[model samples]
Target: MIVETPQLILRPVGTNDVSALVELDSDPAVMRYVSGGAPTPRAVIEDWVVPRAVAELSSRRGGGMWVALDRSNGAFVGWFSLRAPRHGTQPELELTYRLRRAAWGRGLATEGSQTLMRVAFDAPDTGRVFASTMAVNSASRRVMEKSGMRLTALHLGDNAETDGYERGEVEYELRRSDWESARFVWAVRGSTSELTA
Candidate 1:
């Protein structure tokens, strides 16, 4: 599947993205919150990450991973995913995004996340969309809030060795009912503006 926003084009990840994924994970800054600045080995991306993404895409169970690209120049910006919850049932997908350092502070993460949330809720079966990040990762928290998800829980840390793990994790969620209400308000306001115009 393919999706587009004004600033990005998101498509299913493939073998071609292995190198790009490696480069993205290689940046200590990019992986700071994820792996405590340890670069993901290229072999992992090739053997495990890419294959899993491919399988997710093929299964079409919940939304899979999508590689985000710059609309103007087609640069590899990052990847976004909405997948079935590991510990939860269907219709409750988890949202996630990982972008290159160059993409930070550009609002691209929020843009992509908002788009995916819409995609999830557009499906009649989807009941909720949620995400989690290290509590210390203010940037990611802001992205989740900007995407209309509210903080639902705070998970205590269990692994001191993990970077940012000492600070714990925050979970955010948007329910289908809330999303529908917000969309309705936007639709009404849009029509009002058009009528006034």
Candidate 2:
């Protein structure tokens, strides 16, 4: 599937994205929160990550990972995902993203996240959309909030070796009912503006 936003073009990840993915993950700053600044081995990305994403794309599942590109220049910015949680049931998908350090502070994460949430809520079967991040990662938490998800849970880290494990993890979620209500309000506000004009 292809999804476009004002500043990004998102497409299903493929073998061609291997190098870019590796480069993105190789940056210590980019992977700081994920792997304690360790670069993901290229073999792991090539032999596992890309193939799994390709398989998930073809699985006819409601969600999969998408590589994000800068619309004007086609630069690889990062990737975003909306997929079933490893231990969670249907109607509740997980939202997650990782952008190049260069892409930070530009609001691209929040923009892509908000768009993906809309896509999730468009499907009648999707009852909730959720995301999780290290509690100390205030930037990611802001993206979740800007995308309209509310804090729902805090999970203690299971591994002491992981960075920021002591602070734990935070999960945020947006329910279908809440999304619909927000859409209605936006529609009404737009209509009122048009009438006034």
Candidate 3:
């Protein structure tokens, strides 16, 4: 296991996960926020996505990609990712997650994200962790906020495939310094809720 939360186990995405990944990408509701509501092709999962995930894990350029599993029953729940900055290796990284429809509305996103945030900030070289989503993807936006990220920017782009192209995409960020300060307070308060309060 790469990282384990109370209810979830994060493991590296491996070549054997192609079928599970295909099952995930084949759900319309799960793919709604991605791929313009179309299920990703199985060939795409086998030939492209799986290879990339495997390579990312092997490179360890950053946290790489992970598969989320239920701790109790050992079922596949979803996947989460922490990747290096788009341009190059840097102290900043990107956070992302996707879940099986069955896992929706269960607070698993926030839980897994909180775990990732802790890992990200714990690294001495990490300066910030960031995430982005379509402006209309309120569910994902809420996850970012609950994970302690603040809205940082909105980028207008050619996201014609998404519903809210006019409003563009939204970026959320949490600096290591801000997380450290809040963590200290949480330690003192002896409650996780105090971090948000």
Count of residue pairs whose backbone atoms collide, per candidate: 0, 0, 0
1-197: candidate 3 lDDT, tens digit per residue:
38887788999888788889888888888887786678888888788777776776565445677899999899999899887765766688789999999999988899889888876665577789999988889999999999889999998869677666667889999998889887878888787542332
Sort the candidates on TM-score, descending order: 1, 2, 3
lDDT for model 3, please: 0.82
Is candidate 1 or 3 superior in lDDT?
A: 1
lDDT against the true structure, per candidate, is 0.86, 0.85, 0.82
Number of colliding residue pairs in model 1: 0
Top lDDT: which candidate number? 1
Residue 124 displacement in candidate 3 (angstroms): 2.1
lDDT of 3 at 70: 91
RMSD of each: 3.4, 3.6, 2.7
Off by over 4 Å in 2: 191-197
Residue range with the least summed lDDT across 10 consecutive positions in model 3:
188-197
